[model samples]
Target: MKKNLLYVTFVNLVNGFAGIAFIPLALKSLGTEGYGLYSIFVILVSYIYFVEMGVAKYFTRTIAQASNVSEEQKIMRSATGMYIRITLLLFIITPILFFIIPKWVFPTNNHGLVSIIVIFASLDYLLSIPPTIKLTYNLGKEEFEHISKFNLISGLSKHLFLIGSVLIFKSVILLIITVLLRRVFDILYAKKFLKSMPKGSWQPQYAKGEFKKIFSQSIVLSMAQLTQITILSIGTFLINRNFTMKEVGIYKATFDLASKVSFFSNSLGMVVFPRFSSVLKRTEEKISLLNKMPLYYKISWLVYSILFLISLVIIPIIPNILNIQDMELFYLLLYGACLNAHANLSYEFLQADARLKEVIIPSIITLLMMSVIFYLTLDYYSFYAIGISWVLSQVFNSMCMDTMVLRKIRKSSSITTICFNLIISIGVIILYLSLGVY
Candidate 1:
């Protein structure tokens, strides 16, 4: 477990550099309008997780519970066939949506090109799923080092290709092709790794009642995932639709920087999930988990504090480094990130306990609130309203998760503490807005 945590942490650290570098290169090469279209394309790809129906997560939990080599192989074989069907279905449906949806959502003049790019990108993402099945299997088996090693290769290749393609071609078509080619390489490496593992069949077959059972369980998780994605992307979507692509570029740039912190939390969550699943059935082990909860929470706060401090120092330099004009959005986004950090730790625990409802229910509520608030304020405030709505929604979500988490763990959390945090968050936002500090 310790080794897996270390490996995943290292992978996130390496991936962070790529993430930081890729944004400026993409923005410089594509320009604002082109980058805005690219942002929509990426958001569309992110939504593909909705189509995935949480089957990848189901694979992790199912395979983790396997008793022996034979059982594990059988689980993998069944999962691979199921995943293939899902991928094929997505490949077909996504392109059709791309054809129909872009016309209504984007400027009519650019619809044709955007549709073509979205189709290609969707196909590329679908093709990447076969390799994902293998990677998820390794995760279930606790082969963290192996997963991290391959991820480094694939991660570096993806960014390098993105940077090279954007620098040379400055074409969205070529940028997506770069992604497709990276997936092709990843597929080859994944297949080679599988061949060296305990043998698993790839012959597609539908097992009796198993698909129904898995889908039933997975759908809840899928919904939770969808809500989470909406929370993350709603601001981007609203900005793109209501404002200029140049404004969208600024918003997404700030978001990308803030998301680096989330990348670390998610990496740690991935490590925790399967390990927690392993001991979930044992009562004594579950108690042990509770006992260590404080330690985990402490560590999480420590990490968040370090990240928050670093952001304070780094955000001012970002505008100069990337040659961006606006740094106001960074203040809003960084505050949102700090608010989310504590809630994310709570989310990880609930997810491990299969209590996904707690995390996602608040997300659904916050989404509705954000949408309404952004709409009501759009005429008067424009993009600035989106920033305020985002921070307010984060506070709402943090309160919901923090309260539920404390109750579940039998930990005492006073109303004074929650109210104090809320007051502080609101006060800080007020200060920023009143002073126009950002």
Candidate 2:
């Protein structure tokens, strides 16, 4: 576990540097409108990739709990088959979407460029299925070091390639193609690793019963995933629909900057999820781990709070650095990201324990609330409406999940801790609104 955490940390660190370089470079090469188009393309692909429907998480949990090698093989085979079918479906759907989405979503943009980029990006995602399934299997087995090394190589290479390619070519289409080529390397590495494991073919083999079982177990998780994606993407979606592409670029850039803080929570969740899955049936162990949830929250809160302070110093400078406007979006989004990090582990814990409904319910409510807020405030707040909705909804969602998690283990609710974080979050918002610091 220690080694896994260390490797993940190193991977995220390198990728963090890559991210720091990638965005400003992208902005320089693509310009604000071009970058906005690219962001929309990426978000569209994410929505399409929802076809995955939580199969990866399902495989991870089942494989972790599997008692024997044969069982693991069966799980992998079903997963491979499921992925293949999904890939085929994407082949048919991607073209149709590329045609319709640009016209409907961004009628003013270049449809030709958007279509070409979306097609290549969709293909990149399609080609990634095999490698992703294999890597997910490794995750299920707690082979984090192996997976982290793969991520380190894949992530760093992709970013470096994008940074250099955009500098030279200044083409979003080329960037998509670059990502597709990088997947070839990923597939090779995942295949090599799978060969050393116990005998199991990568060939797709469908077992109707197994497929149904996996889907049934994963559907709730899929709902949770879809809702989460909607919540995150809604801001970009709304900004693009009702405002200028330049605003879309600014919002996405600031959101990306704030999202970096989530690296800690994301890495921690990755390491602990398998542990949570493995102990699902063990009451005492589950309780013991649940008892540690507050420590996890505090660690996450501390990291977020520290970054929140640093952001106060840095946020004002980002507009000049990135040559973008509306720097204030960073603060509200940072607060949203912090609230997200606080509840991230609890979400993972619930998912691993197959209590996904608890996770999905808050997410659904948050999405509805976000939509209502966006509707009511868009005329008054513009892009700031998106930020306000996200922060408020995240606060509600985080508290609910944390409280639910504590209740699951028969522990007293950490209302004090929850309230403390809530107070700080609210205070930050008040400060931002009253002082109007940008």
Best by lDDT: 2
lDDT for 8 (candidate 2): 78
| Weakest ten-residue segment in model 1 by summed lDDT | 408-417
lDDT of 1: 0.75
lDDT of 2 by residue, 1-438 (tens): 777888777788788778877888888888778778778777876777788888888888888898998888877877778898788778788878887877886555577877776677687788788787877788888888787777877888888888888899897777777777888888887766442344664666786587677778788889888887887788888787788888888888778777787777778788888888998779888778877777677666667767776777776755566444456677788889888887888888888888888887888898888889888988898769998888888888888888777675433447666766667767766766776666
Which regions of candidate 1 fall more than 4 Å away from where they truly are?
A: 105-108, 192-197, 317-319, 411-437
Clashes of 2: 0
Q: Model 2: how far is 13 from its true place, Å?
A: 1.9
Give the whole-model CA lDDT for all candidates, comma-separated.
0.75, 0.78
Number of clashes in every candidate structure?
Answer: 0, 0
Q: Tens digits of per-residue lDDT for model 1 on 1-438? A: 778888888887798888788888888888877777777777877786578798887778877788898887787787877787787788678767876757665543477777886677677777778787887788788888888887777788888988999999998777877888888989877766432445744655578987788789888888887888888898887886787778887788778776677767767777877887787768899877765665555555556655665555666655567544356767677777777766776676676678877777788999998888888888887777887788788889877876665564544533544555566566655655675555
